[model samples]
Target: MEGVSPEPLRSELDSKSKHDTAKEDDDALKDSTEAEVTKIRLMRAFVESRDPSSKEENDLMMRRFLRARSLDVEKASAMFLKYLKWKRSFVPNGCISPSEIAEDIAQDKVFTQGLDKKGRPIVVTFAAKHFQSKNGADGFKRYVVFVLEKLCSRMPPGQEKFLAIADIKGWAYVNSDLRGYLNSLSILQDCYPERLGKMLIVHAPYMFMKIWKMIYPFIDENTKKKIVFVENKKLKSTLLEEIEESQIPDIYGGQMPLVPIQNS
Candidate 1:
């Protein structure tokens, strides 16, 4: 864990600790809310850059990070408010669940010891200039979920029976136009039979693809194109490229249990 990022562990879950039932608006908490926003940014940058020797080490670091949280600090309600904007902010709106997913996956592999060696983030970076959420105030915000299940890897010799898994996370913008455009233009647009149009969607579990493709023929042409299938390996590499190979806190927790889909 020497070189690993601790951003995720250091994140601003302050507001989430307590159920924010302040239904009536409180404009009074506005000023300090902005300050917490700054800390969130700082902490986010810290978490995404955490690099560890192996997935196990990364997992330990994350566990520790979670335990280190202090309840004294107040979470920025304003930040969650950004989720209401949907045009420019990057936050959660509603959850995207695969209609059905694997109950679980195998575990206990030796060679791939740490998080980095076994983690694969299923990410989708859309080119949306503006977006807004259809889900109103009552909607849930999006967050990343990383799961690892013991899995077979295409390795050679003694390393052949390696374990690896999918780490899936969704990024959203709040108070931004970019969010709305992305959902409308890319995801919910099409009846693209082969949701796995390219290797882009391979990271998505089998059930998601199945439902996505099943409803494909009902969507339009342009939207279907956005539902591309990408390789897990390439997605991470691309992130590295974008940041000039800088380490971010996105670590692999456990082995991701992937639902196998037969290639079309």
Candidate 2:
């Protein structure tokens, strides 16, 4: 009797302890959210101070950079500023015109017709149809921007990424464009962070694997995770896993026809 508290007193103490623990957890969560918000505001201010002409800047865009940089405000700010500078110089007129990339578009290699299960827009590229342009790297670079911007425009609200399918079935050495591939990787990774939802490489032959091996090293770890090489035997079934059969392109045994990127 002398060693224990009364039953009523013990019950009241237990309830108070539980309430205190819950309050502590709530306070911690609130503090963490406020800290993140503060960081985002600081980053927005810093980026705007450096690039006042960034009319398209907003919290969502800033958040993308922040997430890409693991929420490091300084690093995200620097990356965002670099992107702004590159966009200003490369896209001086504000957007890449179809006429400017007419040759690449005429190749009809790139198409976008449907969305994945996640609602991300789909982009299909027929590598066999793409030949290295006589106009050099600049034209191809602009073409990449054009295609990417077009795909981005098609994204629905709240969706920030798109899916890619590269059909290299008939690809040969003649279709090889190492510089073009490197430029594309650089632009996608550096300029358009977190924009690629996934990339499906279909019917990739032995020669293509060698090219991929070379290109693979340049891909960042995060981007590399999104790439998938579908087996020939399971191409249709594999594609069906992430895309509705109706939305898959006819060429891949799905219902939809391939719409050229320029047209879509």
Candidate 3:
């Protein structure tokens, strides 16, 4: 009994099951490859049908559109085309020079610094420094792009995400501009999909929490999941766990200094 092998029929069944599983895995892989090929063809055809002379045939660009639209070919194509149109109008020169929004850069409100432990960039926003003005909305929008561009420029290969910390120290009703906050959130969450890794709201006052309740409903569930509220007591420890002490600023009980971008 100690040396007994499995019965002949049971051994054969086990062998057959292993072979079946291997074959199933192979078939699944082949099916996935074929589906990807078909999707690429469909994406190209859709773009060509709309713009015969289009030069956007890169697979990465197509994949970005697919991701933006959840891999629906028709929707992705439309979104890509619309993006092209918007890009042309928003950035006619295909670039946003630092000089274009010099005044906005002077605000010293938003700036992205060192990377976290996961290599994701860190964006720090001082709400107390940001004040809404009627004539500054457009410039502020450009500044948003400028901040994104700065962070994106710093992104190393294979890194596609970033973190944010909104410092609400000294923030009051005068600093709370509901319309501006919504617009900025939309630009970051909607226009720039899949970029945010997390957004920590630190030192939020009771009044700020009340404002957040109103604005929270407008945020998508996916974006909402990326947000976290940390009280002043926990701010240092919570941030230190995710980011390096040198990377974080002294204002947040870290060693780093908050240096505003002098030129860009």
Candidate 4:
């Protein structure tokens, strides 16, 4: 027999869902506007002190500017704070049989790296290499691990500050890689998914194991406030370790940090 006319209840439910979605969007816009107003009131004009007399001063200025530039991250920060939040390192602090420790002494290598012709780490060189292989992410991540470790080892002791990089390579990504990363993040309910959205896809010359200084941008407000773009040197080092460790877990997920864990 032919189907009867659809029930009024079904139509009403669909209409209600769309109306609710629209109202929610409208409310979000209003909240965002208010936040912008608050931000304007708290901000002040300043110049970028790219060249300062001392390295200490130079680092501090760079740190401040990066912090100031970071967009509202209240959502991202709140969600990550709850998960066992301890800074991680590539080598476990307590592991009796430690991983291989480099023999080279930490020098004042900051003077040597992280800059361009006028003094910058060949960020573009790092980025260009991203597409050189099939596993672009994995290549980048390993590059961070290698380069940062070398930098840290070379950095002079008692230096309170270190270099912070936002290389063009870090922000740029391949279409296929980007889609895969975003998809994995969306399915993850409580994980630091924003790190995926905000991940500084670095194109370091040859460093990160895959996810270095990269946190999923998907997070809550209070938690996001803690996300510093120029991650504190300790945090940067520690996060690198954690991301690396997570990538090469013993008998765990068969996925590398730079490579998409999805197909695996």
What tens digits encode model 4's per-residue C-alpha lDDT throughout 34-109? 5443442232111212212222222222222223335333432333232212212322341212122121112111
The worst-scoring run of ten residues by lDDT in candidate 1 lies at 101-110
Off by more than 4 A, model 4: 1-129, 132-140, 169-264
TM-score of 4: 0.24
* Alpha-carbon local distance difference test for all models: 0.29, 0.87, 0.74, 0.31
On a 0 to 100 scale, what is the lDDT of residue 62 in model 3? 60
Candidate 3, TM-score vs. the true structure?
0.76
Name the regions of candidate 3 deviating beyond 4 angstroms.
1-45, 48-61, 134-136, 261-264
TM-score (all chains, Cα) for each model: 0.22, 0.85, 0.76, 0.24
Estimate the lDDT of model 2: 0.87
In candidate 1 the C-alpha lDDT for residue 61 amounts to: 22
Q: Candidate 2 at 221: error in angstroms?
A: 0.9
Ranking by lDDT: 2, 3, 4, 1
- Candidate 2 lDDT, tens digit per residue, 1-264? 587769978899899987775565345335235656778789988888888965456565676677678789999999999999999899999899888888898898999898999999999999999999878899999999999999989987667789999899899999999999999999998888889999999999998988999999999888999999999999999999999998999999999888888888
Candidate 3 minimal-lDDT segment of 10 residues: 24-33
Error of 3 at 237 (Å): 1.9
Clashing pairs in 2: none
